[model samples]
Target chain A: MPKNILSVENLNGGYEVFVGRRRVFVHAVDDVTFSLHNNEVLGVAGESGCGKSTLAKMIYGAIIPPLLVKGGSISITTKGGEVLNINKLSIDEVRRKIWWIEISYIPQNSMNVLNPLKRIKDQFIDVFRYHGIKMDKTETVEHLRDTLTTLGLPPEVINAYPHQLSGGMRQRVVIALSLVFNPRIILADEPTTAVDVVTQRTILSLLKEWRENNKSSLVLISHDMSVHAYMDDRIAIMYAGNVVELGSSLDIFKEPLHPYTRALIESLIRKGDKSIRKGLAGQPPDLINPPPGCRFHPRCPYVMNICRSEEPVTTFLDNDRYVRCWLYTSSR
Target chain B: MENENMLKIESVTKLYGYGILGLKKFKALDSVSMNVNLERPKIAVLAGETGSGKTTLLRIIMGIVKPEIGRVLYRGYDIHKLKGSTARWYRKEVQPIFQDPYEAFNPLRRVDSYFYDTVTNICGIKDKDEIMYRIDESLRFVGLSLDRVSGKYPHEFSGGELQRISIARALLTTPRILLADEPVSMLDATLRVGILNILKDLKEKLNMIIIYVTHDLSTAYYVGDDISVMYRGTLVEHGPISKVYQEPRHPYTSALLNSVLEPDPSLRDKYPAVKPSSLELKEFLIAGCRYANRCPYAKEICWTTLPPYIDVDGVNVRCWKHLDYKL
Candidate 1:
């Protein structure tokens, strides 16, 4: 049931952002669709100009120019089935064979990806010699000291230096240099947003132990629904750049069919539930010309009036939940 | 809320350079002290994490940094012993909200001219219909409106409406206290509780007292009633946010309330993880218990001294393993 490793479909991007001479556009990623399965994690969530790091920089190929990709398609697949597209490749074949071999991001500042005068094993051999890979520097420092002692890290943090580590050891050396090339899908935008709750639960249990030891597929953005309830297994959501909901992380934390994911899972922080959480009243809708028909219909609290003029659709909802809202189009 | 003694701050200490002619120092607030009860309207949360002096104790309670040896005292008046219109009336009764409402105002100015320059320099309002009726009553007490933020421009608002117009320009100087350093930590967990319900409705409709420097222990236990926490520059735990977050008794507040990440994916692998040490600025200039090297219950006299604040029942808690749960 696993293999869907990164899909996407009707995604669209935006941001020509001029403002003075007036070239606006903003749509930061509307009509978004979601996928990613293989060792599945998904998450995303929303708020804060709801682009979710412009849909994790258009699913990690890290798009450029005032951010382009005006329409759909992403694909990825790989594990040798090799579907690929990734917004029609080439930024040196998406940084030589899909950035870190089939997707590997992790951004959200670990001092903007290490290199403060190198030496966390030379930034893991400058990303394993920019993928050409060759080895024998004492077997690549004993496989980066056995992958930083299988992620519990401290192999003397590979001779320190990126400002001698801390901000959770340079986010565990940028998740052990985005696992040199064991990639398949990692994304992770707000990668435990500026570390601390125990280094955001040890960098989300080292990306759920490197996606259960390389089965891969993670994604995970964050606006913290308890860091997507401790690292997703399917969650999506977004707003003002669409994707009102998607499901399973035990059905969006036990049935949240979008009223902004039930006020963002009732504004979380539940540990022995004392209640009164509330929050979501407004603000998270300006993707410029946004509010025109369900860009979370003017801060949807079950708005109605055909959710301020149509555009609802998505609804699947059974085991693999989907929900787009007008109360899941009147429960289909 | 200033029936005198609005801020006391004694023994502050802010060190920067020293040692090798520059005699090296970086204490960033060590001899810390507190007191703000101007007839109780409090909200003191300088909770830590980011070199934990909590934005250098909110830039030393907003006189914008200066604490070599303490005493801030705003109403019992000592902000480094004011001069010239009493330090501009102690900077208009101490008001600051900065934690980036997109760089807290002046994106080519006009988020209502800092609400008509705090209604003409802290409510002296030289009429323009009483500075547009006190900037439409402090932007309708921060649910915002002055023609939905009139003449807007901190990039036309929305970082939760430019932090509710920077907390309605620090509540147009009816400011008894509102330091708010981490003001909704770069907002957006659903517009961070609409700026934490407009600072818990301006501390219950303007009795006003809010220090709220945060790291977000669930919106500081849903809009704090008092919490101190701060570490690496001391005040390891304060009181009453329902007894320092439900009886914490500091093992760094029970490892920061068991490293709060519960959105419940079946409590994903139960949380213990918290490495953070990579040591060396002489281990945060240790003089015993700077969280005793990630304390699990470190007792070699908790690394040599400084424990004592043990109240326990009324909950002050500094921790020598709760000094035998002292009664």
Candidate 2:
């Protein structure tokens, strides 16, 4: 059996936005739980403002002010078989020890990660030196040249500044910087959102190749279902800061259990199909004060009276699929 | 023949980025031509990625950017030559719906003020009651109402709702041609179809032409009647939507079609390797095919000479493979 690399249990986190002197707390990511095994790709799929990014941040241990991890724990089993609770560690400790060596994070707008003034080679060298990895100028240059060429980039790009490259090339450089340490787990949040389709395909393929060759795990978060379909091995559908459905990628796409997932799949305009695709009527609930019962109940087509008053528990179905909906509950 | 053509673009070319010494020039749009018929209103999709010049072409059509060569003629009158009331009239006839709904409206101002201004100024409406009446009528077409958005600011509404209000504002003038540049790309998947449905309904009910520009192939296939594929400032393929999508003649069009990942996991392994070109500026100034650097079937001839447009069936394709064949 494959060993679990990272396991998150009942992770509850939120952002506190202040209105004048009054502080209002928005529960962005509530009770998000999932496990990523060794060498597996887990996709967290959701629309914007669904807290998918918050969940990734919490896992990567980014707990700055205004954003707090209220409850739950995240455990990562390192290669030495030592379990590290990310929440218990300090920000500096996480950055120095765990981050970029065990767990690396690539944010949504990764193109802006590079410093404009610095050359690409200098940035890579700075990261390594900060980690206390001593190397001379020739060694650093040789290492960067080999890595960039291996990642399908020309070595000459190391001498150029960030603005000299296109959006896609800059994104690749960010990816290359993240992979310098060969972290066991990578949390990539919307890595391909801004680039064009051709560039997106190439980046995704490069990521897949890297993961397979290195035997690492990846948690890919994106709002595009087609992207998740192409890259993910296991899929988790998030709605209003909750994981409404979790299953294998193939099964989830072929037969989605949750009403929100089904509606999202049906709404896509596919080729060779002339039938009208209908969008869901209602908007996503506000994370600050989401609906009481099930968050998706207001827009669900199969909503019941009980669904309006009580939240449905997650039920396990065949083929390792789990869904949070009244339609699949045994009590119903 | 003149009456049949609604909009005619004749060999339009746009250049960008003059270097310090005025030597470097990036050709954004090569010699491109197309004609839209006013007799039958249909959605003509201009599909391509960034740097493909789809957005530049849309801007040229809206008269926002001036082309260095050729002219855009609307009903036999050159758009660049129009002045005063005629230019204002042309602006009313062709409206644009931008990609971001949040950026479309002023944050401090009430969203309805834009609607009111569009009705009064662009539509040339006078009298207090008539302006409100026209605004309400257009809002109703987009499944919105004046009451819901009358006093609300832009921040008060969600992205989807804000986009609908933007569309409602666009409908106030009853534009003859709608240039939508990635209108639904920012919205959620569940909300994108609603906006697309509204566009389709407006095309059929109002008999208006929609020039939809997006990098997405699926939405293009769903709503487009005619499709034009652009790559690196060049028009590579043009034909009926289904014909071009199903039987792509140009290599770039085929590559673009193949790049669209369907929401099906069964075909995951069928994805072909796509090599993205790194030298964007160099490719833009290439003498031959811009896509030749990455094309799988590129030959020596593809790198030396620019291929002429050849008519295959009813579609026009720019490729060396189809040059010898005629419909």
Q: Give me the candidate number with maximum DockQ.
A: 2
Best by lDDT: 2
Q: Write the per-residue lDDT of candidate 1 for residues B138-176, one digit (tens) a residue.
A: 888776778888876788667777877777877777878
Task: Tell me the lDDT of candidate 1.
Answer: 0.76
lDDT, residue A86, model 1: 77
Model 2 misplaced regions, further than 4 Å = B1-5, B18-23, B324-327
DockQ (model 2, Cα): 0.75
How much lDDT does each candidate structure score?
0.76, 0.89
Chain A only: TM-score per candidate: 0.38, 0.97
Clashing pairs in 1: B12-B70, B18-B22, B18-B23, B18-B24, B19-B22, B19-B23, B19-B24
Model 1, A181-216: lDDT tens digits are: 788787878877776676677667777877888778
